[model samples]
Target: MSYAPQKRHSNRAKRWIITIGVFIVVQIIFIAIDGTFLEPSINDSDNVLAKTVRGVLESKLLTERIAPYSFPFFNLFLIVHVVAILIQALGDSISAIFAKR
Candidate 1:
């Protein structure tokens, strides 16, 4: 029922909002940098590996590969790259939700 606690809570919420905003902005900048710079620098072997993975996906061989545990090294690298991106996105989303509260 006290107004002082309410005011403090409001200020804390604003600070969180600003922090999450900054985080999302930085993430967007980094994503742009990666897309524009890092993505193109991948070599021919990487290209081949990506193509092979795509072929496996199109052929519905991923399930079989999963069972055999014969994941190509390049495919594992790609999975790690994708998982890192997912983690970043998930962290940003969670921060935004908590900031909204």
Candidate 2:
């Protein structure tokens, strides 16, 4: 109930938020590069991964709806950032459990 622990938690939360922001920025940079170069070649491959990705890209939910607003990267970043946050949260929880014991 003391203010000290609450302040410490806020600081920790801020640091994690900043870390996730940086991670997402880096991910977007990589996305830009891949979208410019590698994405163009995805359709030409015969691998399962390629096929899966292509299928997702071509799905009506994306092709007919999301694509209309030019929100592909928007969706991509949203999902990526959520995953990054989840991963960090998972790691933090695991560490906290071990530290408690």
Give the clashing pairs for model 2. none
Please give the lDDT score at residue 31 for candidate 2.
57
Tell me how far the alpha carbon of residue 57 in candidate 2 is from the true structure, in angstroms, after superposition: 1.8
> For candidate 1, what is the lDDT?
0.53
- How many residue pairs collide in each prediction? 0, 0
Candidate 2 global TM-score: 0.44
- In the range 33-66, model 2's lDDT, one tens digit per residue, is 6435444333558989877876776667665664
In Å, residue 44's CA in model 2 sits off its true spot by: 2.5
Q: Tens digit of lDDT per residue, candidate 1, span 1-101? A: 55775676687678657756765675565545543434434333558787775566444434354322233333344445456666766875675577633
Against the reference, the lDDT scores of all candidates come to 0.53, 0.63
Error of 2 at 36 (Å): 6.9
Model 1 residue pairs with clashes: none
